[model samples]
Target: MSPTTVAVRAGFRRGAIELRNTFTNAQDLWGYLFPTLILVVTIFFMRGSTVPGTDFSLGARTLPSALGMGLAFGGLIALAQQLVVEREDGTLLRAKATPNGMLGYLVGKLTLMSTTALASMLIQLVPSLFLVDGLRLTSAGAWLTLLWVAVLGLVATLPLGAVIGSLIESARNLGLVMLPMMGLIALSGIFYPINGYPGWLQAVAQVFPIYWLGLGMRSALLPDALAAVELGGSWRHLETLGVLGSWAVLGLVLAPVVLRRMARRESGSRVAARRERAMRQVF
Candidate 1:
C-alpha cells in the first residue's frame, strides 16, 4: 500500500482505540454526560416559558439551537484544546518523528473529534426528545437537513480550530479563544432569538459559523411557521451554506500551512521550555 493509505489505516485504528478509551475512562464519560445534564436542567426551567411572539415552547426551540452550538464548540474549542494539550505533552513531536506520522496524527485526531462530537450530540439530543416538544422529526427531510448542517458545521469549524491550535504557543492562552467563543455564542442566538437584535448585531452574528449552525438546526427541527420569527422571514438555507462553505474553504486552505509551520517548530527544547513554564506556574 502507498504511504498515504497506510497512514490512513493506522489513523483509523488509532481513532477506534481512542473512541473506546473515551467510553471506558471515567473522566471522559463524565465529560460527555455532564454538559448534557446541564442542558436538560436549563431546558427544564424554560418549559414554562414560550418563545417570543408565539405560544411555542421556548425550551424546545432552544434544544436544537443548543445542539448546533455544541457542534461548533466541539469542532472549534474542543479540538483546539486537544491539540494544545497534546502538543504541550509532546504528542505532536512524537508524531513529527515518524514517517507519514503527521498525516496519521491529523487523521486520527479528526476521527476522534468528529466521533466525539457526534456522540455528544446524540447523548444530548435523544433525551431532549422527551424534555422538549414540537420537534418536526417525523419527516425524513428534517433529519437530512440536520445531518448536512452538522457535517458542514464541522467542516467549517474544525480546520479553524486546527489553525488556532497551531498559532497559540500554550494551552494556558486558550482563554484568548474561549472568551471570544463565548461572546460569539451569545451573539449566535443559541439561547435566544437573534431576530430581535439590532440590524448591525445580527449582521455581525451572521458572519460566523455558530449563528448559521444554530439557524440551520433550528430550521430543521422547528415548525415552518417559526421562520416568521427568523430574519427575512425564511430559513435562508442558501445563506447558511454560503457562509459555512466560505469558512470551510478558508480554513481548509490555511490549516495545513499553519500546522506545517507548527510541526516544524517542535523540538525537545521547546517542549522542555513549556514544561518548565508550567512548573513555574504551579510553584
Candidate 2:
C-alpha cells in the first residue's frame, strides 16, 4: 500500500482506539454526558415557548440550531484545544518526526471529533422529542439535510480550527478563540431568530459559519412554514452551501500553510520551555 493509504488507516485505527478508551473511562463518560444532560433540561424548559409567527415549540427549533452550534463548537474549539494541549506535551514534535505523521494526526483528530459531535447531536435529539413539538424527525429529508449540513459544517470549521490552533502559542490563549466565538453565537440566533436583529447585524452574522450552520440545521429539522421566520422566508440551501463552501475552501488553503509553519517551529527545546511556562501558570 502507498504511504498515504497506510497513514490514513493508522489514523483511523488511532481514532477508534481513543474513542473506545474514552467510552470505557468513567470520568470521560461523565464528562461527555454531563453537558448533554444540562442542555436537555434547558430544552425541556423552552417547551412552553413558541417560535415567532408560528405555534411551533421554540425548544424544538432550538434543538437543531443547537445541533449546528455543536458542530461548530466541536470543529473549532475541541480540535483547537487538543492541538494546544498536545503541542504543550510534545505530541506535535513526536508526530513531526514520523513520515506522514501530521496527516495521520489530523485524520485521527477529525475522526474522533466528528463522531463525538454526531453522537452528541443524537443524544440530545432523541430525548428532546419527549419535550419539544413540531420537529420533523420522522421525515427522511430531515436526516439527509442533517447529514449533509453536519458534513459541510465540519469541513468548513475544522481547518479554521487548525489554523487557530497553529497560531496560538499556548492553550491558555484558547479564551481568545472562545470570546469571539461566543459573541458570534449570540448574534447567530441559536436560541432566537436572526430576522429579529437589525439588517446590518444580520449581514455581519451571516458572514460567519455559525449562522449558516444554524440556518442549515433549522432548515433540516424545522417545519416548512417556519421558513417564513428566516431571513429570506426560505431554507436558502444554496446560500448555505455557498457560504460554508467558501469558508471550507479558505480554511483548506490556509490550514496546510499555517500548520506547516507551526510544525517546522516545534522542537524538544520549545516543548520544554512551554511546559515550564505552563507549570508556572498552574502553580
Candidate 3:
C-alpha cells in the first residue's frame, strides 16, 4: 500500500478502536458526567453574585474556568493514569507489534479523551444558557473565545498527560505524578480568583499552563470591563495565548519522545518478569 493510504487506513482503524474503548468504559462516562453536573448546578444557583474582582456574574466567569478544569482533570490526569496502567500490563507493547500500532493506539486515546472533554464543556454550557440567571453571552466574541481557549487548553494539556503516562511505573505511583498537577490546577485559579493568592503563590502559578488556560478562557468569556483583572501578574488575555501556545509546543515535542522511550523499556520479557515478580509478591 502507498504510505498515504497506509496512514489513512491506520487512522480510521485507530479511531474505531478508540470509540469502542470509550463506550465500554464506565469510568469515561463518569469523567464526562460529574464535572458537567457540578458546572450546571454551580451556574444555575450562583449566577446572581459577582465573581469577586470582576464585574461579571459568578455564573459568567465560573463556567469557563470550570470547563477548563474539567478538561485538565479529565483529559490529562485520567488519560495519563490509564496509559501507565496499560503500559505496565503489556497492552501497549502488544499493540505496538501490529501494523501502525503505536499510532493507532495513540489516536484512539486522544479521540476518547478529547470527546469526553468536549462533552463536559457542552453539558455545562446548556444549563448556563437557560437556567442560570444574570448569565450573559451577548457577544459572538465570547463564544469564539470560549471555543478557542477550550481547544487550546486541551492541546496544551493532553500531550503532557502522554509524557506523564510514559514516565510513571504503575497506577499506585500515579498519585506522586498527579498531586503536583492537582496543585497546578488549584493555583491556576480554576475554582477561585487568583488575586486572593499571595504574591509568591501567584508567581508559582505562572510557571504552569493551567493558569494561562484559565486566564485565556476568562478573557474570552468574561465581560470586557472585567478583563482588566490580573491573573499571575498580567491582563488575563494578553499572556494566556502566548503561554499556552508555548506549552503546546513543548508537550508536542516531548510526549512522543517520552512514550517511545517508555515503549523500549517495556519489551515482552521485561514486562513478563515484572508481572511475575508482582504476582509472587501478591500471592
Candidate 4:
C-alpha cells in the first residue's frame, strides 16, 4: 500500500482506540459524561416552560438547539483544547518526527471529534425524549436533515479549531477562547429565541457558525410550526448551508497551512521549553 493509504488506515485504528479509551478510561469518561449530564438537567427544567408566545414546550426546542451547540463545542473548543494540551505535552512533536504521523494524528482527531459529538447528542437526546415533548426524529426527512446539519457543523468547526489550536501558544490561554465562545453561545439562541435581539446583533450572530448550527438543528428536530419563533419565521436552511459551507471552505483552506507551519516549528527544544513553562506555573 502507498504511504498515504497506510497513514489513513493507521489513523482509523488510532481513532477507534481513542474512542474506546474515552469510555474505559475513568477520567475521559467523566469528561464525556459530565457535560451531557449538565445539558440534560438544564433541559429538564426548561421543559416545564413554554415558548415566549406559543404553548409549545421550550425545553423541547432547547434540546435540539443544545445538541447543535454541543456539536459546535465538540468541534471547536474541545478539539482546540485537545490540541493545545497535547501540543504542550509533546504529542504533536512526536507525531511530527514520524513518517505520515501528522496525517494519522489529524485523522484520529477528526474521528474522535465526530464520534464524541454524536455520542453526546444521543446521550442528551434519549433522556430529553422522556423529559421534553414534541421532538420528531421519526421521519426520514428529519433524520436526513439532522445528518447533513451535523456533518456540516463538524466540517465548519473542526478546521477552525485546528487553526485556533495552532495559534494558541499555551493551554492556559484557553480562557481567551472560552470567554468569547460563551458570549457566542449566549448570542446563538441555544436556549432562547434570537428573534427579539437587535437587528444588528441578529445580523452579527447569523454570520457565525454557532447560530447557524443551532438553527439547523432546530430545523431538523422541531416541528415546522415552531419556525414561527425563528428569525424570518422559517428555518432558513439555504442560509444555514451557505454560511456553514463558507466557514468549512475557509477553515479547510487555512487549517493545513497553519498546522504545517506549527508542526515545522515543533522540536525537542520547543517541547522541553513548553514543559518547563508548565512546570513553573505549577510550582
Candidate 5:
C-alpha cells in the first residue's frame, strides 16, 4: 500500500483505540456525560417556555441548536485542548519524530473528535426526544439535512480548531480560546433568536460557523412553518453551504502552515522549558 494509505489506516486505528479508551476511563466517561446532563436539565426547565412569538417549546428548538453547538465545541475547543495538553506533555514531539507520524496523528485526532462529537450529540438527542416535542426526525428529508449539515459543520470547524491549537503556545492559555467561543455561542442563537440581537452583533455571529450550524440544525429538525421565525424567513440552505464552505477553505489553507511552524519549533529543550514553567506556575 502507498504511504498515505498506510498512514490513514494507522490513524483510523489510533482514533478507534483512543475512543475505546475513553469508555474505559472514569474521568473520560464523566467528561462526556456531564455536559449532556446539564443540557438535559436546561431543556427540562425550558419545556414550559416557548420561543418568542411562537408556541414551539424553546427547549425543543434548543435541542438541535445545542447539537450543532456540540459539533462546534468538539471540533474547536476539544481539539484545541487536546493539542495544547499533548504538546505540553511531549506527545507532539514524538509524533513529529516518526515517519508519516504527523499525518497519522492528525487523522487520528480528527477521527476521534468527529466520532466523539457525533456520539455526544446522539447521547443527548435520543434522551431529548422524550423530553422535547415537535422534532421532525420522522422524515427522510429531515434526516438527510441533519446528516449533511453535521458532516459539513465538522468539515468547517475542525481545521479552524487545528489552527487555534497550533497558534497557542501553552495549555494554560486555553481560556483565551474558551472565552471567545462562549461569547460566540451566546450570539449564535443557540438559546434564543439572533433576530433579537443588534444588526452589528447579528452580522458578527454570521461570520462564525456556530450560527450557521444552529441554523442548519433548526432547518432539519424543525417544521417548515418555523422558518418564519428565522432571520430570513427561510433556512437559506445555500448561504449555510457558502459560509461554512468558505471557512473550510480558509482553515484548510492555514492549518498546515501554522501546524508545521508549531511542530518545527518543538524540541527537547522547549519541552523541558515548558514543563519547568508549568511546574513553577503550579507551585
Candidate 6:
C-alpha cells in the first residue's frame, strides 16, 4: 500500500484499539467517571435554587455548564495524560516506526478523545432537560450552537493536549500540565458568569479558549445571558466565534511543531533511561 493509505488504515486500527482499551481499563473509566461524579455532586448541591429569577431549577444552567467542563477536562487533561503514559511506555516509539506513524497515531488519539467527549456531553444532557426548568430549547439555532461549541471545543483543546503530552517527560509530571489547565477552566466562567468576575479577571480569562467555549455554550442555552451581553455593548456571539477560531488555529499550528521537536528528543536510549529511573523510584 502507499504510505498515505497505510497511514490511514493504521490510524483507524489504532484509534479503534485505543477506544476499546479505554473502555476496558479501570483507570480510564475513573478518568471520565471522576469528573462526572463531581458534576453530579455539584448538581445535587445546587438543586434547591431555581434558574436565576425563574421557576427553572438552577440545574438547567449549572448542569449543562458542568457537562461542558466535563467534556473539556476529559478531552484535554485525560487524553493528554494518556498520551504521556503511552509515550513513556514506548507505544509512541513503536508507532513512529510505521509509515506516517505520527500522523496516524494522532488521528487515533483525536478520534478516541472526540468520542469520549461526545459520550460525556450526552450523558449530561439528559439530566439537563428533565431536572432543570426554563431549560427549554427555544430554537434550532440554539441547538446548532451547542452542537458546534461542544465539537469545536474538543477540536480546539485536544491538539494543545497532544502538544503538552509530547513535551512532558513523565506521566507523574502530568499534574504540572493539568493543574494550570484546570485552573484556566475555573477562571473561564464554566461555573459562573463572566459578569460576576472583575474586569481585569475577565480580561485574563479571555486569554484562554475555555472562556470562549463556556461563553458560546451559555449563548446557545441561555438567551437572556446573550441579550444581557448585547446590552452591555459586547458582541458575545462574534467574540465567541473569534476567540474559539483563534485558539483552534493557534493549536493546529503550534501543536505539530512542538510534537515534532519532542519526538526528536525522545530517542530510545533517553526513554529507556527515564523508564529505568521511574522504575527505581517506584520500587
Q: What TM-score against the true fold does each predicted structure earn?
A: 0.98, 0.96, 0.86, 0.97, 0.98, 0.89
CA lDDT scores, all candidates in order: 0.93, 0.89, 0.75, 0.91, 0.93, 0.74
lDDT tens readout by residue for model 1, 1-283:
8999999899998888989998899999999999999999999999999889999999998999999999999999998998999999999999999998988988898899999998999999999899988899998999999999999999999999899888888989999999999999999889889888999999899999999999999999999999888888999999999999999999999998999999999999999999999999999
**Candidate with best lDDT:** 1
Pairs that clash in candidate 6? 51-56, 56-133
Better of 3 and 4 by TM-score: 4
Q: Write the per-residue lDDT of candidate 5 for residues 1-283, one digit (tens) a residue.
A: 9988998899999999998998789998888898899999999998999988899899999999999999999998899889989999999999999888888999999999999898888888888899988899889999999999999999999999999998888988999989999999999999998888899999999999999999999999999988999998999999999999999999999988988889999999999999999999989
Candidate 4 lDDT over 197-250, as tens digits, reads 999888888889999999999999999999999999999999999999999999
Clashing pairs in 3: none
Model 3, 55: alpha-carbon shift in Å?
Answer: 6.0
Write the residue-wise lDDT of candidate 3 on 204-248 in tens digits.
Answer: 988787777777766766655665566534455646778888888
**Superior by TM-score: candidate 1 or candidate 3:** 1
Candidate 5 TM-score, true structure as reference? 0.98
Residue lDDT tens for model 6, 155-249 = 78888788777777888898797678778877876766566678888788888877777666666776464344422534377777777778788
Per residue, candidate 2 scores C-alpha lDDT tens digits across 21-139 of: 87789997786687678778878888788888788888888988988998899889888999999999999899889999988888888888888878877877777777777778789
Clash pairs, candidate 1, are none
Candidate 3 or 1, higher lDDT: 1
RMSD of 3: 2.8
Clashes, model 1: 0
The lDDT of model 1 is: 0.93
